[model samples]
Target: MRRREGGARTGRGVGVLRVVVVGLMVTLVGRLWFLQVVSGDRYVRAAAGVSVRTVALAPLRGQILDAAGRPLVANRTVPVVSVDGVALAHQADGGRAVLGRLAAALRQPYGRLAGKIRMCGPGVARPCWPGSPYEPIPVADAVPVQVALQITERQADFPGVTTELRPIRVYPYGRAAGHTLGYLQAGVGRDGLEAVYDRDLAGRPGRRVVAVDNAGNVTRVVGQDPATAGNSLVTSLDARIQVIAERALATALARTGGTSGAAVVLESATGRVAALAGYPGYDPSVWTGGVTAGQYAGLQLLSRAVQGQWAPGSTWKVASVAAAANAGYRLDARYGCPSGYTVGDRLFRNFGSADLGTMTMRGALVKSCDTVFYRIADELWRRGSDVPRRTATGFGFGARTGIDLPGEAVGAVPAASARPGDAANFAIGQGGVLVTPLQLARAYAALANGGTLYAPRVGERVVRPDGTTVRSIVPPVTGRLPASAATLAFIRGALSDVPRSGTASAAFKGFPFGRIAVAGKTGTAESAGHRDTSWFASFAPDPAYTVVVVLSEGGRGAQGAAPAARQIWEGIDGLRETR
Candidate 1:
């Protein structure tokens, strides 16, 4: 009986064990079905998240070339050191140890390197990496080959460090056309043509969908879109002429003890600027890494010939002469050439207060008689006529010349309610009548081009990477001068006499007038508590180029600005001979 009872208990225990084992198998099958049918896609995406990365490929920036196709602004490739922010973040101590090791290898300050890699917050100093945390941030540019090799060879020391070749903007000419060509900051245009045509110059950036492994290494490129290089800008600037203008302006500034100076050379017929140069220019390469406070402060002294405004001084007499002619004041009419003209309590005088007794209107202009213009301004003011204002505005004064540059100053003109004193001042290009070197050049160009006022153009054409012409810039005529042919001719002939026997005669005494009929005017504007501003505006008929030079705090037009203009004209003549 005991044996039979034991056998029954054993059978029961076996049956319970079988039931438990079967239930466990059923549960496993249900979980497998749910995972395979309902959650498979989610798991697959999660797996891909660990291996896929998006890489941005920067496109090559187009070359900024001169009229002769010489590069003023360009690009070059150099090895750069980058850090993977995401991978670095995941490292111990937020990748500080690795960055510290990298700092030693790169010979860079660890604090600065760490600051650049770290995400910036409020109050963080600049030079901070501005890219996304997931993307690789370039820490060192133009890294030495040996340093890059050292970092690459010791990957264990820098888990997230990478060395690769990248394109960087270069200014081969250094400070030659720095203002006009503009400078780049972190692959962005800041000013000049670069800022004005940024969209066209900065081409589309390409992207690549890459597959990276758990070790943060690229396994394969799943998809790629090639970057398109920016279109090349063909400027109207003549590199040779630019050098000549800058040199002349610098020499004149030093000789005259002037603080600053600006010079502009334009194609008289088309109003296309050949060269725009200013003193105290800055090097564009200083912006490669980014400009510092000191560097930027130093650049504040830079002046743009097309943008900055100053009292045009006697160079303004061209407009005054045209205005008088338009108002039926005979060009040949004789007036008393006095040493000084009194208006209200102020006494305005010509250079040296030398009285030439009596002289015609043409003679008055040749000698830059301030009293003659003062009398003309008095008559116009008495008549309550806008002829003077109209004439000045007609010459594109007190307004933007529509130049192909940014931040151009639209100079101020006397208001309608201007008094006789203001009129007198305006007549001589004073009393809030300001003009840019480019504007003065444009006005002189209009006189040279038979009364057509052209909107100044700098871009000659746009071309593709293969040298195919994308589009050519057509010179646009802004307006026509109101002066008659006789008046224009009279003004032209009088201006021609200027370099012969007028204010600029001394400067152009030995110039070859037979080969080239050069016409010009000289101006000196008084500045209270400072040296007078000197000006010289001239044009050569042979090559049809208008050159305007202005020296701030320079003594006299003939002594300071005229000599500089002479140098430029001679340089232009020499250039023609060589070519």
Candidate 2:
């Protein structure tokens, strides 16, 4: 009986021991579940707080080329110095002394570095800087490779400072055709063709998921996303021809005491814009790579020709003549500009303030008599605005040119408000109207090409990186001038007589360029402060080319703009003969 009692007590003690062991295992599993599943996101946050680091990869920018495949805007390998703003914050123990050390290493002004670092403040716990932790601070751009190498060698002391290979836009031709090529900023297109073709020019950016250690240091590259470089584009501008136009315009502007100037050369048959130049033209390289504050201020002051709308002066006469011819108006009809004619309530005065007795249509044009055009404008107004408006549209007036560039404007012509003064002013290229130098160039091309108004094309082609021809720009015939053969002949004869007998006669009297018959007209438009928009548009040798030059504030078309046109003709003829 005693042995049975002992056995029962032993079994109960063993059962208690088994239950305690099971309880211990259950407690351990519950604690593990609480620590892992309940707080998984929190642990991830802790890991990121200690070990995530980011890096940036840049893409290549496209090349801008001119006609004949010469590079106008190109990309060159350049060394740029930058710093991971976030990395510097904690690595340099709040980055206070890191700024001074970085200044010494970069050999830059200590104060400038300090100023930037302080502005960044402290990027700990959360960022105190303007951008995210991955954002880089541009310490300096386009540093010399050797200088960058030296800085990199001592990067241990500089902490987060880095040197990378960057592509920099280079303009080998200076400000040759700045108004057309435009500029780039922050790997993005800012103005002109650069802005218009930003997507094509700025290639795709690459990225990588880098592995970082507990100290927020990049331990490995991990994986990479490769980047592709931008393609190359060819424009219609010829650097050599552009140089000629710029030199001529500058000399003319200086001689005329003009505030601004512009010029363009177009192919008569194809309507290709050979060269388009503007003065007081800003250097394209300055705006693209980087510009000083003072240079930027100066650019702001002279940003006119690209955006300025001005009275086209005598250049508008081309559109008027086209309109007149299109309307089948008598070209040889005699008209009188006796002192001045009355239009509406305004008494319009002749340019010379002298009476031009009854003269034929040809005589009216050669003499540039305000009275002749006045009567013509009145006739058009009487014929209804349709004839004139249609004529202007045919000539590409008041229409924005679809050039492969940004920030272009189509100047205005009078709407059918039917004001009498506008009619008279219309005859004189005044009232609510304006035209760009480019428009005059293209219209003159039509006159040279027997009245086939072709669209103005600027780019030649864009070659992809894979060696495929991506695009080739071709100009299209937009409109035609419907006129009698007799009227056309009469108008052509008068235009030829311009250099032969009119105001431009004195300027081109010598005919130094030889038997290349050139027909042109000169204009002087009135502006504020006695400033004038002087103009000269012409076509030479019929089958060859047409050149148009318009100057603003450039004294007189007779003494100012005309002489420049002559020089341009001389240069063009000389170059052609030599070639």
- Off by more than 4 A, model 2: 1-56, 91-93, 101-137, 187-189, 213-216, 288-295, 300-306, 326-328, 344-346, 379-386, 482-489, 512-515
How does each model score on TM-score? Answer: 0.89, 0.83
Error of 1 at 282 (Å): 0.2
How well does candidate 1 match the true structure in TM-score terms? 0.89
- Candidate achieving the largest TM-score: 1
Q: Which ten residues in a row have the lowest lDDT in candidate 1?
A: 292-301
Give candidates' CA RMSD values in order: 7.7, 6.2
Give the Å shift of residue 463 in candidate 1: 0.7
| Per-residue C-alpha lDDT of model 2 across residues 247-297, encoded as one tens digit per residue | 999999888888787777888888787887788887777754344334455
- Residue range 1-579, candidate 1, lDDT tens digits: 999999999999999999999999999998998898798865675677546677777788888999999998888888889998878877879888998898888887787787677665577566566665556788888888998898889899889899988888887777787888885564233788887777778888888897766666566788989999999899999999999999999999999999888999999988788999997687777776565445566674345597677888888887888889888888888898788888777887766898888888788778888889988887888789899899888888888888888878888777765555788888888878888898888989998889999889888998989999989987789888778878888888888999899988988899998777889899898887899999999988889999999999878999999999999999998999999
